[model samples]
Target: MRMMLKAVVLWGALAVAAGFASIGAVHAADKAGSKIEVQKSKSPTTQKAKARPVSKASSSQRVAQKGKVASRVSKAKSTRVAKASPSAARVGGSKSSRPTQKGKNVAPAMAGGVDLWQGQEHLAVRSGSALVIAQDGGEALYEKNARIVVPIASITKVMTAMVVLDSMPNLQAPITITDEDVDYLKGSRSRLQVGSVITREMALLLALMSSENRAANALGRHYPGGLPAFIVAMNRKAASLGMSRTHFADPTGLTSNNVSTAHDLARMVAAAYRYPLIREFSTTPGATAEVKGRELEYRNTNQLVKSPTWEIGLSKTGYIQEAGKCLVMQARVADRPVVIVLLDSSGKQTRIGDANRIKRWMESASASGKATPA
Candidate 1:
């Protein structure tokens, strides 16, 4: 019986030990599950850290896009500024339009009704002084330094012709070119020899058409009171026409003292246009004068008078050391009668280029219906 009881105690001990082991295994399992849950919770933080580079890349892209947008906006503002500036308009909106060197004083003025074309397309004129006016209404289409007095060079021949025609001298009368007719100041060359004899009408034609300095001087010397009296008459005529800024020192225009403004010259051109002979003679393309039994060929000084594209009623060109490449004309451009005067052009072709530019600008304005009537 004692042996059976000991065996029972051993069996009881085994059961308790097995129960304790089961409790310990359950606690270990609970702790393992808690650790797994904690690991899962930390997984989101790890994912957020991995995603930082993507967020930074997105920020950089936004910054680059903003920079591009700002650059475009800045360019747009600059373009608007250029379009609004007058000096910029003169240069066709070029960055080099900023006034520099001799072009600094060439800013377009709004005087003399030029404001009529304000905000319209500006002309790119290379001449230092220029003027354009309508014949019908005497309205100024364009003006730059028009009132400023400057040397007119050989353009004085127009006034000389007018004075000679006013005297009603015999056109067929013989006028001999003498040594006194020679250009002393300018030493200019002429086809009319020292002893060459030509009719009064022929001399006038050569003087106006060919710009013969000797022929012009001869006409002055043969006047009623001599060359001095002829100069007085020129000044008197200028006063009558209200050319307040005009003065004539010589009839041949060889003297740089023969000065007149573009405004005064415009008036002189208009007056000359009224005379049928002045218009015919000045616009003659080419003529031959029988001088001393030799046929001497003479051509018009102004080339625009011969151009078929230009309906020039009158034209004259002048040049000297003081007066740089001057040209004046009354022509029909864009179907409007206009008087154009360009003076002090630096280049031989600059005056012609400025004329063509003015024509195109007027035509464009007319086509766009932006041009106003005079």
Candidate 2:
């Protein structure tokens, strides 16, 4: 009986041991499944973290493109501004327009009549002293330092002729070119040789058309009180014409002391235009003179006078180192009578260019009914 009981106890202990081993295996499998799930969730988190760098790079590229676009837009705006401004337009006479190197700065005057203002595109002149006025009422249309004083080289001849005519001198009187008529100051060459003889009318014509210093000197020398009296008369005439800023030291205009403002020159031009003799002489494009039995052909000093495109009533050109190229004229432009004065120009062609620019600007302004100020 004892032996059978011991065997039963041993069998019971083996069955319990097997049941514990099975339970332990199930617990280990559950722990392994939980670890796998945690690893799977961590894989998605790592992928999301890797994708963030690419998103940041794309954002940086978008910002860079925006900056480039803004730069292009700014450049376009700058170009437009430059095109609309006249400050970029070249101004100065000679080969180019230069700003005033000497002289007091004067404020620009307002355009008062007919309002013919063409913006900077119309009146880029190199002359330091300039003016444009309507002949009908003497209204200033455009001006640049018009009130400033400056030397007017052969422009003195206009006043000299006026004084000669006002004195009622014989137009047919004989005027001889002598050593006294030679330009001693500026050493300017003259086509009329010493002892050349011509009628007073011819001398006047040569003086106005060819800008002959000798002819002008002869005219002044024969005046009522001689050359001294002639100079006094010129000042008197300028004063009478309200040319407050004008003065003349000689009729030849070789002296730098012969000075006048553009405004005063415009007035002088207007006064001279009324004289039939001056109008005829100054506007003559070409003429021939007999000097020592040789017929010498002389052309007008003003180039515009020879152009068929210009209907100049009165014209004069004057030049000296002190006084750059100078010109004054009364012309019919845009169907209106106008006076133009250019002074202290630097270039040989700048004055003519300025006149053409004014003409084109005036025509365009009249057509469009918009006048721009220079």
Those runs of model 2 whose alpha carbons end farther than 4 Å from true positions after fitting are 1-114, 118-122, 371-374
Task: Give the per-residue lDDT of model 2 (tens digit) for 1-374.
Answer: 99999899888888788778777787777778888888888989888899999999899889889888888899888655544433331222122321222332222223333333235333566677778887653446677788889999988889988999999988999999999999888889998999999999999999999999899999999988798988899999999999998889999788899999988888899999999989889999899888898999999988888888888999999999999999999998877788999899898888888888878867777667564332
Worst 10 residues of 1 by lDDT: 98-107
Off by over 4 Å in 1: 1-122, 372-374
lDDT tens digits, residue span 93-147, model 1:
3535533222322333232333334433356778988888776435466767777
Residue pairs of candidate 1 with colliding backbone atoms: none
> Candidate 1 — what's its lDDT?
0.81
lDDT (Cα) of model 2? 0.81
Candidate topping TM-score: 1
lDDT of 1 at 162: 95
Candidate 2: Cα lDDT at 108 = 25
Per-structure clash totals for the candidates: 0, 15
